[model samples]
Target: MRPFLFLGTRAEDLAADGEYDAVLRFSGLAERDLRRVRLERDELPPLDLDDWSGIVLGGGPYNVSDPDDLKSPAQRRAEARLADLAEQVVDADFPFLGACYGIGTLGRLRGGAVDRTFAEPIGAVTVTLTDAGRTDPLTADLPGSFDVFLGHKEAVSALPGGAVLLATAPSCPVQAFRIGTRVYATQFHPELDVDALCTRIEVYRHHGYFEPAAAEAVKAAARTATVTEPTRLLARFVELFARR
Candidate 1:
């Protein structure tokens, strides 16, 4: 089996590693089978889809829907690179799964509306699977409703062109979606646990997902969340694409 490519976009050392570790844990990929790349510090190579089993994109502090002037140089570069990759991935229907930031990047790339109107606070939320989600191979085994961790400043306002809505929450309508059967995106962090959320809350305190004064409360709330179901989506992505 070819190695899976994991792209992460976090500048902070601990935050970046935490994202990678989550993907590694949920996907059940060995160190050798998973090739992790920090997009915040590295250039995106020409993605030859055949060279990798699939691509996994992790959450980040950058928001794609932000105004041009507010975007940093690194964010701009990452967005451009991801847009280019999204085109290729969609055109070829390549195997891919994007979490958090993935929804904004790929959703916007595919002509969907992504905005801050549906932003969710940092915590766990109940997400119900749609009829399509119930039958979709990636989500079929998942419970009809389950909890997942999510914190974002922007979300998909509607389904992207040619995308299927898989799961949804009251806070954000488009919680999870799939494109061309092989490509998937989720607003929630499928790989996160309480410890992981605490780490992120600490690392990203000033990034405005929540007020600094609320950090302790946020961490405490995260501790009480039961979100074991979403990890299955990550494992399912690996199981479906690792050999091909």
Candidate 2:
């Protein structure tokens, strides 16, 4: 295996480290099997699917639902670059696991309607898997319902043409989806756990997932909620994708 590539975009250094550590812990991947690429102050070489076994994307404060006028030039450039990156991932049906923000990036590329209509604040939510999602190779071993960590202001309103809706909650109709055989996306944070999420709530206190004053409450909620089931599913995804 070449390595599992991680692409992250969090302007804050604290947020960046939390994202990186959560992914590594969830995947249970050895350092040799993972290569993280931060897009904030780094340049990405052209994506070559042949050289990498899989790609993973971490969540951030950025939202695809923001209006173009509100986006800075750098943000716009990053979006375009991600689009170009997804082209190869989609065409090759490259093994991919995108959590939160990556869901918007991949969803937009696949013709899914992504907006603020279904935003879930910081907490754990119950999710039911669709029949197709239940049958997906990555999710086959999981139960029909499970707890997942969520903190976002946007979600997929409608799945794309060729996508298989994997999971859903009453608040967010599209919690997860699969593109082709290998590409996958989750609106929730499958890489998050109680302690890890608490760390994030501290770093993202003002990112607007919650009121600046309510950050402590959010952490308390995460501490009491169950979010490990989803993280295990994410680990299984990376493990199985390596077999293809």
Per-model TM-score on C-alpha atoms: 0.98, 0.95
Q: Residue 79, candidate 1: how far off, in angstroms?
A: 0.4
Candidate 1 stretches greater than 4 Å from native: none
Query: Which lDDT tens digits does candidate 2 get at residues 1-244?
Result: 6788898888888778877887788788876788987776677889768778799888887788899998877677777778788778888988888889878888886567888898888998999999987888888777899998888998888787798888889988898898888888998888887887888888888778889899888888778876657878668977787643
* Tens-digit lDDT string for candidate 1 (1-244): 8999999999999989888887888889987888988888889989789899999999989998889999988889888999999889988989989999889878986568899899989999999999999999999999999999999999998678889999998889899999997988999998898899999999999998899999999999988888889888888898888864
- Per-residue lDDT, model 2, residue 178, is 88
Clashing pairs in 1: none
Residue 231 of model 2, lDDT score: 76
Q: What is the lDDT of candidate 2?
A: 0.83
What lDDT score goes with residue 94 in model 1? 92
Worst 10 residues of 1 by lDDT: 104-113
Model 1: lDDT of residue 14: 96
